[model samples]
Target: MRWDGVHIAATGVWLPGRLSAEEAVAAGAYDADEHAANRIVSVAAAETEADGGPSAPEMAVRAARTALRRAGAAAERVSAVFHSHVWFQGADMWTPASYVADRTAGSGVPAFGLQQSCNAGVSSLELGARHLEVGGAVLLTTADRFSGPSFDRWRCERGLVYGDAGTALVLSSVGGFARLLSTSTAVDNSLEAISRPASPVADPSEARRPLDLSALADDYVRANGDPRRLTLRTAQVADASVRQALADADTRMEDVSRVVLNATGRSRMRWQLELQLGLNEKMSNWEFCSEAGHLGAGDHFAGLDDLVRSGQVLPGDRVLLVGGGTGYSCTSAVVEITESAHRPE
Candidate 1:
């Protein structure tokens, strides 16, 4: 949908640290061949909370604080807070969004949490843009910590490596750094089974089993026939979503200065988006993403932060952010930088 009054006021990202792929291989936590195939050099890994490190919510708060400061928005100025995540955030049956709101944007801001897999960040941005009124501001945050006993970041997925990080974006109706031109989403519900648990939902034991995305995808492909056909369809849908977003923004593909895509893998990135959209690797944030791994829903947000901080995105530059979630959902957004922010050191 086209947006008239929405702007990306500021963005912030908080990464714990990086764990090299070589280190993972040396520790027998990852396969060297697979790491070479994925072409991911490193991944952001969070330190244990026992080391005085921040938890998921705490990380989100840190990012939010930075974003709010950059936007020059006080806690009371924020109208809402939306937190997105891919895994558990410390506690069970608890609301991390409320905690984030209380710490950053203050109370009674209608804070809430959402899970649309990796698409949650962009999805929340879309929702927040639509919810914003004149002069109102919305705080969007995404965070995830993929540790042991629940998830093995390096080996959980086939061609993708998960990372631990928190990202925040302050969206406001008041003018700011970049204008949110448009956002679009497309879904293929039939592909949802590709990530579904092997066991029944009634059994929670299935959740404890080390996540095997490769096995799940293989089973789904075998049952559905032709894996190549499924891949083609995904690429087509993603292309269509991006095209629609560009159209809504009244821009052409060639007009985009940068593209932020999911940090899946080099091969998948080439086949899925770059090839389908006729974009070169230079137009995408592959170098930064390769080091960070997939920051769940925060990939696009973090990419935006990198682009702005590195001064690759300047005033009047148009940027495309695309994301695909495990629930077989795809989303795209077009952003136009209206003002250049100070580059980070």
Candidate 2:
């Protein structure tokens, strides 16, 4: 009745209607030709689709199925599911996890949802790693739709950098990729002053509503009070979380090789890490988030995909994941690339 080593077996991702960085810039939403842009970025605008329902569960199910299929694992093999949806794709109704389970091909599996905002992926990963007592492959899904309610609200730097995305990662009971050596999530609630400043539809008294995209363009203009302060505080905790998670994993900063930071833009990401993580020396960023914009909960998982694709993560290579969510939660995870994960491109 104990969770041993938690390993990532496979990863699956779904990008919205594809858009190039050039398109994003031309659209006046972002600048693709910006200096120091990661050559690896190709923006994706996740278009809302009819999946029998407009719900986070539907989006997550699509992603989960893809990831599990890539891993060659049946839905029934999934012992648990962790679903993270930051923005309200669906209105406040029931927890989206239940719908995912109901739609999951597997007849009887359990799923839980976490509200760590951008850090939801890593937080969910940590949860699956601990649910070893459940004793089965854990399929984690992170799916978010930032466009709805802010579809055209890109006038702001933060909103402009947002893109729609969904990612699925599977962890095996026997362990797969790199074991979840340890995890650290730090929250500076005092700095909760910053935010995208949108009203959430979650009604504690009512079942979660279905996904609504009518307000997509409206929410983006709702800028938070202090973007600068929020960014600064985010970097602060990211730095501390890195050190703490590294220590917990029994590893050292010097020993760490690759780092995946999913901050929205290159400039903001660079500033955050340097001023916060204290990495003024040298480092490589997969930078998937920039061109794609911020993919809500999918940032870290999607970033990991970039790391692997860019060859930053080869078998036996150690990679670090750092997440800075809106709630001011900082999370870090150490991952090792596995041969199986080095799937044929």
Candidate 3:
């Protein structure tokens, strides 16, 4: 949706140390041939909380603290906290969003959790922008760690590697560093089954099986006919989302200084980015994303943080962020940097 007077005051990202593809192959955690084919350099791996490391919510807390501090946003000024994630957040049937809000914005503001799959980050941003229409600031945070028995970061899905990260963006209706020009979303719900198993698990034993997106995708294609049909439809939807976002922002593809997309591997990146959106690889944050791997909902926020911190995008440069999730939904947003900020040392 097109918006006015909504600005991104600051962004923060907490990324753990890297786990190189070579090390993963040597440890038999990754296949060398697959690594070569996907062309991923490394992925961010988080230390387990059982080993005295921060859990997913703690990571989100860290990122939120940084963003709050950077934006000079006080507790009373924040209207709500919106947290998003993909994997289990340390416990079952607990509210991680409340925890994030308690630690960052105090207990006064209401907390919400969004589950829009990988698109939840940008989607939350879109929602938060609307919340600003009612007045106070909104904090958007996303965190995920792909480390557990239920998921194999390297093998859970084909042409993709999962990474662990926490990201936060503070949006204010008052003023900030960048102006949020517009946001748009498109959905093709028929494609949701592409990530669902043909048969739902009936037993507890069956439910614990590791996620195998490749098998699920195969099942969908086998049942629905050709896979190309899925690809074509996805591309068309994403293209329309992008076109509308740019149009709403009164900006063109050629006018954008950068594009940030999901942190998928090389082949899928080529298809969705260059071939589909017609954005040059250099103009996109593919290099940084390849090294960090797919960071669930943290992809867009972390990428934009990197661009600002690294000085890759200057003031007045417009940035386009495109995100898609397993629900077969796509969200695109346009942001225009209004001024420079002090880069953390």
The whole-model lDDT of each prediction reads: 0.87, 0.65, 0.89
The sequence of per-residue lDDT tens digits that candidate 1 reaches over residues 100-119 is 99998887788989989998
- What is candidate 3's lDDT per residue for 1-345, written digit by digit as tens? 789999998888999999998889889988888888788999999988887778899899999888888887433489899999998898878999999999998887799999989989988888999889987799999999898688899998888899999999999987888999999998898888888777777764777358878889888888998888888998888888899999999998899999999888888888777788887678888889889999999999999999988888889999999999988889999999998874654
Candidate 3 lDDT score relative to the true structure = 0.89
**Per-residue lDDT tens digits of candidate 2, residues 1-345?**
112466776677777665676555677655445523533255566545554333445667777777677665433467877788877657666777767766763646777888887788887777777775566678888877655444442433332355677778887765555556677878887644344224544654442222322233234324445545545666678777888888877777766777777645566566655766566424646345656766778877777766665566677777778876756787888876665355563
List runs of model 3 lying over 4 Å from the truth: 74-76, 203-205
Comparing candidate 2 with candidate 3, which one achieves the higher TM-score? Answer: 3
> CA shift at 311, candidate 2, in angstroms?
4.1
Worst 10 residues of 3 by lDDT: 200-209
Best by TM-score: 3
Q: Per model, how many backbone clashes are there?
A: 0, 23, 1
How do the candidates rank by TM-score, highest first? 3, 1, 2
TM-scores, each model vs. reference: 0.96, 0.78, 0.97
Please say which candidate is ahead in lDDT: 2 or 3. Answer: 3
| Candidate 2 Cα errors over 4 Å, as ranges | 1-4, 20-42, 50-56, 72-76, 105-107, 148-153, 156-160, 196-233, 278-282, 309-311
